[model samples]
Target chain A: MSATLAVAAAQAKTKTSNYARIYWPFVVPAGLLVFAIIIAPWVFTLIMSVHEWKVGEDPAFVGLENYIRLFNDSRFQWAILRTVYFTTLAVLFPMVLGIAAAVCFHKNFPFRGLARTIFILPMMATPVAVALVWTMMFHPQLGVLNYLLTSIGLPASEWSYNAVSVIPTLVLVETWQWTPLVMLIVLGGLASLPQDPYEAAKLDGASSWQMFRHITLPLVWPHIIVALVIRTIDALKAFDTIFVISNGGPGTASETLNIFLYQTAFAYYNMGYASAITVVFFILIMLVSLVLFSARQKTTFQ
Target chain B: MKMRGLPGKIGFALSVFALISPAILVFLWMLSLAFKNEVDNTAFPPVFIPNPPTLDNFRAVFEKNNFFHYAWNSIIVSFTATGLALLLGVPAGFGIAKSKASKAAALIMIARVTPGLSYLIPLFLIFQWLGLTGTLTPIIITHLVITVPIVVWVMIGFFEGLPAELEEAALVDGATIWQAFRFVALPLARPGVTVAMILSFIFSWNNFIFGVVLAGRTTRTLPVAVYNVLTFEQISWGPLAAAALLVTAPVLLLTLLMQKEIVAGLTAGGVKGG
Candidate 1:
């Protein structure tokens, strides 16, 4: 009896080891990749942010001087304001338009599927390609946008060429590209909603708008929140379209933090300042994400 | 109830048409530009249709620029990054799902949420130090930053959705965990794999910033090549449109072919958007 008990214990030990073998081998690569690729570099970024170094030069420890300079810099302040303004528009337009589009597409209309497919085309198309097409369209004299404006008895304005209108114009391009994403997410939520409420509301003489406001809106609020967070984060880091179209041009009009960071790092060779910008940019994104995520949790529970 | 028949249908259809026309018109304009001559493309009225659609823009794209070479580079970078991401992420996803390792999964999510520029700066310095810039190797590696999280995230959702009883039964029958995963879970996760693969490929293909910073002139991807055309060449709308269309064509084709899977993959998780 004792011998048999000992043998059983040995077998259990082997089994546990076998499980560990499979688990470790399977999970280690991903952990290692994330560490090497993401966490390590970010740590390096944090360290570099405190130093003063240009490209091809030895680093010197500066200890928050870059951050100090950033605080006092008017251009940095403008970038912060512009990023907020751009993100607000980019998120606002898409959420409103996408929810509206989703509601419209949710109905039993003809060619709804076809219309949706076309709408999402802009979303799926490469960003650089999208920017180039829009750049051509935004041309002051030769572009079709101006041509359309004149034909419609409206004035032709310098789209991205003028400093004052550049952020809005860039946001317009962003809205064109991302509205479909919001629409798709909301459509998913709409499809899965319980039909009992809508059916009961109709019987009780609620108008369609009333039903949408009372039932549909509350139900899909979580989805709208999710879309809001995603769009906000993306718009904050929007690089390709802005970089390709304006390159933070017309004398620093549309230079969001991402654009400024790129120019600082690559174009100007200011590595230390760029790293500082990266750290701040990362914190801003995290703060926004935290707020939205907490909001998501609240709505999701409700 | 008042407007319930043919008139309602017509009105609904018109509304839908008006809504989708902007989306359609953008593509149509690009198409017209690609097919029109330089004179027709730049006309103030903007020729809506090419009288005779010309392939000359495409010809110019290939001849004047090394368009084919950049396209090849893009293909290689996207394919390899996607392939490596799958190899690394699938089993990891399965392990996390089975073990309920939420911490590891969250670690990977941090990778996704952080800005790409943060990664780019340090990686750029490291690569320059290692003499690895200007090679497809660095570009492909950097793309993993985009691709791996996507694969891991999607696969986690899929693997968790899978029935656990099958793997347990396999384990109870004396099959090891690896065998169970290889034979049972992986096969069950085929649709997930397909979705992950397609989404990662589309994303890696569309990525521009990594290539912009890392690639040499000869190693440029199609998007970078298009950017060069815009910046360097005189603003010839036809060739510019043609170049843009070429960069977009492969992704556009993928979207059309596997749109259902793409949508599923996209909506599968919300960690990575844009």
Candidate 2:
């Protein structure tokens, strides 16, 4: 055993040395591409954020003025508020619906595969197309949504047009498009869960809800947190659906940080100010992600 | 609350359908819109199905704009990006898997998480400086920001799932490292390759922001075409929905066909990220 272990150790050393030469070649191409394409530009964004730059003018260094200006920019402030509101609300429905659906599909049931296949389609379809479809459905007079509402003995209001109801309306669309993704993530966890604990709980005469609430939910907490992190990030980054549907419409009522940043950079030609927003955006994402990660770690080890 | 036997089965199926029907109903509505005429499209008591369904809306979208041209640009950009991503990503995945290269993996994941707008700003200026704006080249290159990481990350999952003994056995049989990867690992990863290829293609095809920032009038992709139809032309629901469907139909079909693999691919990233 000792001799074999020594041979294995020697083999590992040689293999690692070979890797030192070979691995760099294999990794460098992809590394260089990502660095050149993503990382380098990100660094440039940081640099550009500090400079007073605009189109057709030479850039002059402006220190922390742009960053400081962001605090006083009301539109940017509203954009941040709208973004938080959108992400928080958008993530809730999908988690609840997705978990319920996952629970439904977790056990053996008739036509479960077919049901899941149908359920997953919405998340798979193109976002742009999904946006347009929902936009047409949200139409006030000729929309199917209003038709369905009135058929149910409920009054119909302007869907995306009403500033008061716009975020909820958009959240409905978001939930429609993304609940399947959450279901997909959670279903993966459900499929792999051990049956032993479930059987033990059943032996104790635990009710189904009790079994789920105690055994299943604890085991699935990590997976749920993963879904939460991904959903939060995607929700924060949401652009295509909003861009196509409202274009941040109804008088900046729905304009999120992404829209504000885009307009500041491209429309208003305030590159420096936009870059400052980008930096803050990055910081916000990192902080939220760190919190989520630490939470996931706690749940996973427990 | 447990309904045993037949009633329970029925209830489960009913609940599933209730949860899923919104997506189905909306799709049916989209199809109805795409097949209706302008009069019936805007008609109150909105036509659930077009009476005497017309192909004129599809024809109008195709004729009024160069739909095929935009589709061509989409095909070119996605094909180049996905193909390049695969070529670069597979070996990178293998190397990272074997080396336990966590930093490399994290580096690639940055491209995945960084907002496209951040890259859009500087790359737009850089492409302009290089005089490469208004062409397909920049669009294809920028799409790498989406494709390469997807390919690398997905492929890493596949390669890592593979047992090390297979490669060791090949090496024992007098195969070189290159031959072992080529003969043993590559063949085993064919399914992973297929998933990565399809996903990268579909995502690149679906991308709108890059094309919006980079493409000239004649160089736009299909999603942009859908947007232009909404903005530049009249809001004829029939033609608008038709363009939207045409843009998504290919990917939607592929997703339906490969639901299981796609789910696995998507969740693998999430699990690994966790």
Candidate 3:
């Protein structure tokens, strides 16, 4: 009621008053929607994490047992380690390839725009769709990949089907899809870069490679960092490709944290345990994001 | 980022082709698979292009599945969600920009930055309780979790870039705050609106996780439909690639055509709305 009166007063005063006074009217809907969808679910996850809950039954209070069990669960531990491993592999290829692509594209060229437009097609393609296409291509016997391998005098190996190779194989798919995204971001940075330093380096008779290493690399470092941060966050939350490709694999080999939490809740119906995983996983992501965000703040985008 | 002369041009061309071929090869492979018969798809050396190209796979995609219904569902859910996001998000973005509310902007960031699965289970349960599962409503509403942030953040950038003097002049003309915003600020942010709409629509259309969890069979969106095609007992590469291609066709065309706008939106948002 008081809020209603305030809104009315703000409206009446709107003709002569400050615009900032009406902040709530503009801000609150998005806030409320976010709260209802993201925040409320988050709080509910917190509550559910502490209880022994499953589908078709009431949640029983379990306190720290779920968290304790999660720590002791070797599979959960493996998921964490595997998630980190996957994130590293996923980010590394994309970063190196993307940066190289950006640098290569940064030079003057014909059909540059058309080539770039084609390059980013993989990134823009639907993730699930991309996974499916790659899954066919990854088939051991009938697939193009093995055919190509034999053509090149290499042995055909089971790709995502092999437990040991699942994560790396999935990372290959990920790199295929997202390297273009990193290229695009880095290219944007490369485009905006001031030319004066390069001119100075040229005047000083610096070699091309030296100009790149000393001049170009330093200026574009911030953009590279931004791409790293973005890719890190993205790679950590990766699901669609991994899910469709391995479905956590021949065993639990490719089951990253996201997949683990998902199966725990949906497949196993261990809601409380899944919720516990959710909290831990969410916190883990938040911590990584926070670290990157702070690092980003120190670099750029402030 | 520009260069001169023949050597530089040749070096650039080689690098560009080497960098770009992986992407082109995969897409071309998908196209080939979509056109090939199942026998040819599994042939020892994969056919680079289908010799007798067939529309049979495309036919199977439409016939074996309710593809058009799912496409319609995708359209309805994304359109409604993107519309609602714009309605709520633009003003919030403007307010956040004008008020210098980094916390609020960060709050929206928190919504999107969290993993989708973290919220999916609970939202699924809530929707079940509300008896809104098996419908488009939940999918549309839940998509706002991600879409609103994209719109709000992108629009905030656009609003920040708009000249303040234009709005100040409107204010000085005895225009109300609402008038100044509706007449002066919003019109100038047209490009931002387009970016927001294209981005939100594309993301919502392509969203797999939310559609997987919340949507029923009839209500399944394109990604979910394509996923269902994959789970069928025998793996038919022809039908599978065809389904995937059909699902991605609209978004791909949009991205290919509006390359500049998408690039601007991407660099500004600095996050994957794809």
Residue-level lDDT tens digits of model 3 in A1-302: 99999999877887445545655578888888988988899999999999998888998999999999999999999999999999999999999999998987777667888888888888888888888888988898887888899999998989988998889999999998889878878988899999899898888888888888887777788888878878888888898998899999879999999989889988898989999998998789889977876886675432
Q: Can you write out model 1's per-residue Cα lDDT over A1-302, one digit (the tens) per residue?
A: 99999999998987776544557678888789888989899899999999999989999999999999998989899999999999999999999988988887888766666677888888889999989989989999899999999999999989999999899999999999888888888888888899899789888988877888888998989888888888888899998999988889889999999998988999998999999999999889999999998987765533
Residue B187 local lDDT, model 2: 97
Query: Which 10-residue span in candidate 1 chain B carries the lowest summed lDDT?
Result: B265-274
Residue B26, candidate 1: alpha-carbon lDDT? 87
Q: For candidate 3, give the docking quality class from DockQ.
A: medium
Runs off by more than 4 Å, candidate 3: A1-20, A295-302, B1-7
TM-score of candidate 2 against the unseen true structure: 0.95
Report the lDDT tens digits of candidate 2 across residue range A1-302: 99999999998988778755655667778888988889889999999999998966888999999999999988888999999999999999999999998888776766677777788778778888989999888988888889889989999979898898888888998899889878878888888888899788778888888878888888888889988888888788788888888889888989999888888888887787888989899888878888998988765533
For B117-199, candidate 2 gives per-residue lDDT tens digits of 98888888889889997789999889999888988999999999999999989988999877888899999999999888888
Can you give the lDDT of residue A224 in candidate 2?
A: 91
Clashing pairs in 3: none
TM-score of chain B of 1: 0.94
* TM-score for each candidate, following the candidate numbering: 0.94, 0.95, 0.94
